[model samples]
Target chain A: MSAGTGDSVSLAAAGPILFDLVAVIVREQGRLSEIDGQTGDGDHGVNMGKGFRMAGERLRAQGEFTLPQGLATLGDTLLSDIGGSMGPLYGTFFTDMAEALDDTDRIDAPHFAAMLKAGLAAVQGLGDAKPGDKTLVDVLVPARDAFDAAQREGKSFADSLAVMKAAAEAGLEATRDLVAKVGRASRLGERSRGTLDAGAASCTMILSALADGLVQRLHA
Target chain B: MNRIINDPEQVADDAIRGVLLAYPDILAATDHPRVLRAAKRRGEGKVGIVTGGGSGHEPAFLGFVGAGLCDAVACGEIFASPTAKSFHEAFKAADFGAGVACLYGNYAGDNMNVKMAVKLAAKDGLEVRTVVANDDVASAPRAERDKRRGVAGEIMMWKAAGACSDEGGDLGQVIAVAQKAIDNTGSVGIGLSACTIPAAGKPNFTIAPGMMEVGIGHHGEPGIAVMPVETARGMAGLMMDRILEDQTFASGDDVAVLVSGLGATPVMELYILYSHVDAILRERGITPRHRFVGNYFTSLEMMGASVSVTRLDGELDRLLAHPAHSLGLTVLGR
Candidate 1:
């Protein structure tokens, strides 16, 4: 597994890459639910875990699949099996990302950035939340911006991913200070402040996992 | 935690199964397990009526499926909106030839899922329109009424849309009536205690024993204010004040009233509350043309009650009187 092949991970390994993402969600289910309980119905973890686990099971049975195929599978699973705002939000995110990466054989910095942008656009369009609404958009916008900025500055793919992960972490923490202006928590007003939005927390974890998985698969 | 169920995670699924077993004659299974259609199919060319939301609101979203109500329902996890796939499937199940009219509450999840479902239905050449109920006046200010969340007043919206569809209203007409129904309606709730999500294993929020949450949402979303628990009469007066303040009911106007127990509250208590509500309406010179008091919509095991009033005109009054049959509601013909 030592680096030697190329500067990008082959899209052929999408199955394993996505499985890792699913693992992260499964592991953090309890934490996500706890955060959501603070200002939401508290089913985010259970619903997200259920949908991811279903996709994980299918991926395991499939054994081998392209990155686009894997992303579509996960996206469709969430959109169809999970009911809630997350279902459509994340569903559109992954599904649109898959569509952006469709027909691509390998993921490089430019290709990855496009996928991120696509997912962000689709989610933003669907949820109608802005950058500071204390939703997942809080994390997504910053993370994507950081990645694009790093790439534009001519940073290496791995370095760009590192910055993206860092920005995502910062973005997630920022939600703790912002008041929710949309979604279920908006009704909570000032009470919604001081708590990390569940969507932002989960989004950070997802972005971190994706960055780590891609960095590990990068070759010299 | 002491719930009658198998796995806490499977509560929603298991409940759906039980519903099918108990009301096989009233509801029929759809292609997707999460979707259910009415058993007694109406004639072709009638506008289809569909609604969906999270589970745990027993007989709601699902129980409302029958001859003159929702033709199909998409069920989601407890207090979560139904999946886009389920919504699309429910739309399919309900549609016979004419377009489908989706009547649902104004929640982020439901809104997004219904939007996606509408897109999917369009691909299948089926037309779908939606009317989001935002009758919980306390959820938002009058200037931002569009932002308020839907509450028990959803039942009123459903009844109106279903009756319009049954009476052979076009999709536009049905949507217009449903929109009008919710726009003319106002609702408010008071939470005396918190309810636990089965999977969460504990109450997400709490209401002090001596205090109550005014304008509490169905899923325990924080209300506008928390104050000392008032007597049944006082509580009724407070709730009436909120609703009346949001929507005007002129003297001698006819209105439909609904009093729903939030799961843990007893029906006897609801009746107690209703007595005061009735008296208040009479004092205002408003006639309660139709009244429903029971657990029409509930937030699983939450001890509370919500009051809803929908002003009626000749059309809405006739629609409310239209004979309808469903697990959660039934109206006899004139």
Candidate 2:
């Protein structure tokens, strides 16, 4: 279980990671909606909470879901049940990540990096948003790139996860200064500034929770 | 939230259920529960017209589903876009050999959902075209017309496209007519109060008792200006002035006008506003060829109204005169 043992947590051991992500979304639901209320319609948190809660319930019912299995369930719930822009975006994200790690029981640094890249691609493929569009892509692109950079620099999986979380937080913070260019807030133009994007904020929370869960499970 | 509903989270679902019960003759449920298709199918070669938006704008995204109108509608959550799957389902429901035309507003969620839905439909070998309505004049400058929001004017777009489809136009022709309708239209909303999403349990935004937000959006998005509430005449003049400024309505030009109450506004007030609107149009020598004044489009229980004016040509005039049947709007003939 040493950092350099090339060790990996079993996919079954990673199910709680999605549970952690769901908890994070549920806790921040009000804050996320308040942020959205500043510019766009304030339903981001409600929709995210509803989707994540549904996924959590399904996962709990399964009792022994694997990482990819849990991710697939969550993605399916969001894609099919949730009705918002964030649903398909994050649904595709988790679905792609699940597919990327489907064949792997060992979640090594390279494999994790590949998963992050796949999730990022899935989000960008569905949304026309770029990094500066003040949308979830801003957090996702940077977080994915940071993880890849840490991996390329020969960092441990734990250290790469730390880097990803930090980058995601910073990306989320940067959205406060950005004028929305893609979502409903984009209609506000300059009025969209001075507020954090609800999507980016929720995305950062999910990414951070995910990173923390992975780090704790690295030695399990 | 002091409202009628079975479940707070299921407000949209319950409302849709009620819509189905109330209008079974005009509406039919598709494979996807969120998608409501017209009961009467179009002719064999006629294009299928489709539109969708978030719920709470009743008689809008769903109420417009009927013969000679939108063939199908993808119903979203209270104020959220419908899932891409729902949009795809609507496409399937509307597709009948002839290609489908998706006529909807220019909102980010709708745009993304429709984009994915089109991709999904393409996988199923269904051809779907789209015409996005961006007629809210105050939402963006003329230079950024594509960035504007589509408000009540979306009804006009659907009407024109549906008429085109009923006339046996192809998908491209329907899309073209819908686009023309929106492009020639300008809309502006004035909000006297805010509406609450039942789930949220409170209004998303606020307007002071004596103040009104001019150019407000459907979902309580901030408007261009906040001013003291004015009489119906004054409000009509302000809204019409903004709409007229956005587009040129020349002397003797035929125009179709729609004055829609923003949910809680009474029909009496809407007609009062429309009287001023009609007077202003007459003073400017802009003939009101077709006029619709009612709660045609609404935003939950927000107390407000929107004015939409579409400059019409011979083709558009014909489309306006064409027959339509829907819960929200119905026209017999010239």
Candidate 3:
């Protein structure tokens, strides 16, 4: 049931798991913010954690939010609950993903891929940013590309997830050389060139964590 | 990417409690539908002035409610505008009947939400008037500035306008004066740091160290230029230049200047910035009517600064000297 793309995971079973996954994700965001506080603003981790926490609470209160509903809720929550501008950007990603999933009970690999693509597109729409901007897209784009490539090789959903995790790890490291082109840190211009954007770093880390968490849970 | 948070939905609720616990000078209207709060009521007949927005602006909508500025402020969740019901409820709790005036930045959600609140109050026969701070010259030129987004400038607007409303001016007259103050205002900001949203737990945007986004608003929106982060003097120059370009206040013009440290910027740095900014204004021969520097407006610990200059006539200066008894604006006791 917890198989590859196109494999439908029921909301009942996946719902609780997804809710927990979000909890873990929220924790991850908090850690990221703490790290960010050292050089960047200290609120990143807390903000991300806040966004996820709100989403998790909503899920807990109302079990098994449909993919679209859950994603939209996450988006709106990020926009409203998490202060700062990033809320709308990330919130848009989830909102778009959820909108793509409208009325669907479960998502298959292709649908999931489409959803990811939509999420990426939504981020771009909101920020006018790109992968090389030393943004979260550095990891996200590569992960999605790798996942798609693995699918082309007839790999299982799990295998594609592995591919995504690998690509995201590589992307995260790759960011160490990139420069920030958006937000306040970008103002550092050249100074920001060597250091990976805390945002991109944290975003990639989350992708890496997500894949790891999912793989371990699925195997279990 | 791991940190601890209990029930996600309860974060705001819990945070509200934390604020009340930490700052007793403030009284959270946890008792009301909207999170309207203020410094303890002092029973002064000073006209009431209130300001509010989403929760992320923090000490902004709440922190500024005492001592030097406002009487009451209604809070919504982070980045989300409080609903009309919330504003109406806040007015119910905040109005002293001398008159109540609401001040906030110009954002659609806030406008829509607060507008409904005003209408509701008017229907109830409560005299209410409104003023919007459209200070982001980065978003538009002066002619169209009113249509542009309001960012951190609401602080200065409230400071001046709150004074007017706090005096015995009728609601309409007070609102007119506030609107005039807003019209005379011009502002722009630059971001040296990116702040995160607690819910997202990651950066909303990133800037490389030594980099900056000039003309940015508090929400981490893109600015006119992305340049190398420079010395504090250079940063002040950059922000001031944009504001100067965006509005017209000639040399020898008497102006009330607000040098705001968007959260995360300390007063020490703000003073350093003031030195640089003051030098620029002097060079341009602009007469300073009044000047204030502090972290009056913030975006959840984001490191940045927004400069606001409101051209003042005598009427403006006189009203500014009027009184209020908020926890923040206690000096100007009503």
Candidate 4:
């Protein structure tokens, strides 16, 4: 794909990024639990919504924030506020991403790729999950690779983000046929099949909302 | 849907407030609201004992925080693990110059949180070791015992570990005995009905009427068998069969028995089940040295019971007999 308009988004305009994520979590709260209830405790949406809402409120109180600042706040809130395996896993994911973008005011393709790679490394450091483990890593790994592939092909930043979102969605859907190898659902063994992993579903929603938010602010 | 709670989302916070008020002499709040330390301090040189889990299992994660038991506890949302920050704060609360032994169940959330907490504690120059309990026999095959989920038998691990620490054992000794306690212990549960997480507003799983789930997990996870509900006598036989198959108790062995109701189960029914369990033990020539029957650990309000048996050697017997003062289980004897 040829590079569409060579454009970038200002990190400052992404301060409200988590607000969009909170809305998505709030909207999909019941759906996420419904999916989790199939093989797990059915609180993925509740916990995610609680954390995202808390992050959004904190961002609003700050009045103005850069994208990295907002993500760091979200990460801190999840790490300290939410419990369960998801807390540390996602907490490190966002915190590491924020750290990668700490010095960047303008988020270009390479910067976004670096942020995601850092986030993935942080998550892997915290949990022993890999792709096909039916965890958030399922969505994250494929999404990150898709974003990097698009960037390498000289696609516009917005186009790369769109590719990441589509890849995440596909990865989320693929979890339904895979048995859980990690987390609470792993106890079910074969029974964990035929159900979408709660973490993967929420990860998809977060990535899609984030990509959409960044895309809206991309300026040529 | 009928629970005595203020806000579904704030159940953990509200219940903690009540716990602090109800057990003023037993627990003290830490800087982190989610962590509680023993009101009676363990002076220097004693290895601290810590344990924690989700909040719905009351008289559990927090109720066990007291002298001679857990020195500190990290409370979590219902059926969830406590935050890493909370676990780290609990480690700090229990740290008394000596190292701390964090004895908790083997669940994914608890494992991850404790791993992070240990990392955080290391940064602060604190030493924290862990012994994860995996006494539920039906969760996995014998070859995959490490994958099993911890059930009510975790209380036995804490009982032995806490007493060992109280006896001035070092951190390594405390963890060793706790690991032995869990290794010798075997437990299984039967769920008559599933419980609901207040926030979820519905049961995570279900048990059909007149049916029971054998080997059910503490969080309502499906079990190995779902058969028609049997008589208390029959249920005891089934539970003991699984427990015994996992851990061999010789004819002359002594064991400690714990029959805990899964929240909503009546105390009367637990005693009824315990009677049958005692009879089965007698038939096998296994002597029950100490028997504890109550809602020691539980789901939110699940209608079921779990039976845990810990084969006691000399060291475990002495440790089990140690004086412990906690809201959940108390032994008062020198």
Candidate 5:
């Protein structure tokens, strides 16, 4: 993805990079399930890994995908195959993110920020969970905000991505001390404390993988 | 354990194949593998009735698809919600020009999936309405009833909604009846053992050999209390007390009682438990207008049973008595 040796990347060439994200989820499936087992049914890994792998295989077979096309394909696969709440939740998230970039040819800090915000908004619209509810929101809100803050500070796109990833990690860690107020884990109430939220963990992994992919492809 | 499955991950998919094979006359496959429609479609202008949820409940989601029951169903993985695409497909399959009424349990996944599916269906110009069933009184306190997980009581909601739709009720009428059915119902379960999700390869939760969990959910979600195993009468009395406390079923009230085994339990045991439930209702001057005793809705192999009672009025009574046919339940003209 060429950015004229400047601060943006070409959305046309950013598709294949998502394969890296698929690999991350597939690789960490076990760990994700283990974390969920502490407070949930422990199938988070199996379900998320299954959806991501399916999307990855389909994209590989299709031979080419623009960033928006790839993300849309991934979102559609998850929405179709994964039946859990995750199917709709993450499905809408990526699908909405893809929609935000539909008319854009290049991805810059502002464009990236908009995509992140669209994804987060889609999730919030579907579920009633807020930031401290020990869900992906915990990671997603902070990640998007950090990226926006860094961009407003006039930081480079790469530095903004790093800041976003760090904020996502911090948000994920913050869930361990919070009582779950939504989802299946919320049934545990106080017992849910001390366990890293499975959704938050998955979100962090996704955001980290995304940031790394964008950083690698940023020509400047 | 010794599960007869080809691939653990494909269990849900394979089970659908088997169900289709066994009930070819009653059900037909949709474009989506996870959605099924009734073999005999109804005429246009009548509101369509649809219901769906995670699979392992067997007769629940799919079995309910028949002539006078759900027009279509979206099947999910065991103890999981069906995908939004699947739900949208189900809505399309069920729609016959008068809009579709989506009736389902109040689970987090199902709620999210259904919401997305409704949005998708709306985009396609197909109107889809929904009624979420939350009749398991033991899952949450009375003040938090909305947060309760739907259990066997969902059957009553479906039966009423199905009857209403079959009688040519409009979309709003179908939705209102479904909501009223669930509102007049309450359910609670006693789990004696745990069941495994084929993909998971092990039991997700466990119960002691000599102990039982009261108010346990279909997926082994923890309930209100855990105590030593009790007699059939004892279990019936305990479950009934919780339900009556949640809903004011006073003397002279008429109700429909359904006792469903949680998969592994025998039919004889369900009747044994139902006998006590019937006796308790009669003793309280509450008449049991209808009784459904069997494995209507179930967990994979969890050893337990749930009791559901719907306080019936003139409308609910007439609706419940309406003839219907499905693999999970069947009613003949009375």
Candidate 6:
């Protein structure tokens, strides 16, 4: 999204990119909290931001490593980060992604898809959600599935993952109709129906960022 | 909005810092985000306990972390279960030769997240066992108690777990002891007015004035029924009657009772509800072994309270009576 290429970007490029991404999530958490506040206990964006800021600082200090290195950094940062619910959900995403792409300098489409799958499985393992739980999975689950579908249709890595971004966007949009079945929003019953889930929105942002990075790299 | 917070996104971090600020002597921050544990694992050769969950449940997941209770608490953001990595970090900080027990409320996110964390830790050769508190009777029927939400009943579970650890029991024994408490517990909650989350700048719900929702959850769960507002006495009777419908407690049964405030409920009102609760239980000839009243598990300042009754055997009474040193609860003095 910075218009700077995301392909084969050095850890230097990746570090700042990671920082920016983390910062966005951190900042967006407040906005997310507001949406959830309509039906949840609030504190969405704040915790989300907190978790990412922790990851960002780690990246700033030690993010100059390889892709796997950066991912492991993110994983460790996420695991220990205490901001809130997103800590593990996002943390699992990074940790699984790290494991999936252990040390690749730049990942192609197949590996990228594998990373996405692993991240999805990790989140599912945490049982933080199903597709309509109105949490991050609402966005991530669909995005991952769409990426898989597009890849199966023989779309190029760049084109297929591009669909992932759209899927994530659509997933985030779909949250507006989902009455929360979990977390604080579930308590509000009908009141929860009107708002888009904060986690879902953030999940879309994360996937979209990854898509932006991949498209830049693959196209270039 | 009207929240007593610095920024919307910084709430959990700021509040976590405040927690460290409040209990400098007992809890210490870890390298991970938002995680705090006892400054040191017991050099005392005692078993260690680790408990945590989403932020905002205050005095709950973290406040219960101290000498006689949990050695570590992995604080996640409010309402979101903590990640597995954070949960594993807590296990390392708290594990003693006696093994570690991961205790928490049985919410879906926390359950799955902590499960992954504990699994990772076990791979590292740490003896880890998982125990969840699921005691809210209002969320499901008696035949389906396992599927109920873990509301105010978590307190009793933590208390029992901490007490077992304090008595120097092995981790398995501690978990077994906690299992007993969880098996005997039942809880019900009600909401008079919906709560407002600070950052969101709007109420989480909009219940009409003079109307109350019955069987509301700790995180502001939807109630089974919402109707005209009932008096404290009527509300107490309603909650008690519903809870007792399963005959969880019989005449002459000794019990440990909890009257918990859901975020915004005033203590004065909680006491009012308690008086009626005690009266209702008394009419059924139940003897309260102990009683606790206060805001334990919250819903981001929602106005509600839950009543929980755990039929107490002697072991549970002792476990409840063990010395506790936490931020919100510290009568143990040790």
In the order shown, the chain A TM-scores of the predictions are: 0.96, 0.95, 0.85, 0.95, 0.97, 0.87
Residue B55 CA displacement from its true place in model 6, Å: 3.8
lDDT by residue (A45-130, candidate 3, tens digit) is 66677668777888778765654666677777765555344565676677787777665655556766887899888777656468
Q: Which candidate is the best by DockQ?
A: 1
Q: Best TM-score goes to which candidate?
A: 1
Rank order (by DockQ, best first): 1, 4, 5, 2, 6, 3
Residue pairs in collision within model 2: none
Cα distance off (Å), candidate 2, residue B101: 0.4
Q: What is the TM-score of each candidate against the true structure?
A: 0.98, 0.96, 0.60, 0.97, 0.97, 0.84
Worst 10 residues of 3 chain A by lDDT: A3-12
DockQ (CA atoms), all models? 0.88, 0.70, 0.05, 0.83, 0.74, 0.39
Residue range B212-317, candidate 5, lDDT tens digits: 9999988888888899999999999999999999998999999999999999999899999999999999999999999999999999989999999999999999
Report the CA-based lDDT of candidate 3 relative to the real structure. Answer: 0.68
Candidate 5: list runs displaced more than 4 Å. A1-6
Candidate 2 vs candidate 5, DockQ winner: 5
Tell me the lDDT of candidate 5: 0.91
lDDT of 1 by residue, B140-190 (tens): 899997899998999988998899989999999999999999999999999
lDDT of 6 by residue, B119-181 (tens): 888799988898888788778777866667887787788788887887878878989988888
Model 2's DockQ? 0.70
Tell me which of candidates 3 and 5 scores higher on lDDT: 5
Fnat for every candidate: 0.93, 0.66, 0.03, 0.86, 0.70, 0.57
> In candidate 1, which residue ranges exceed 4 Å CA deviation?
A1-6
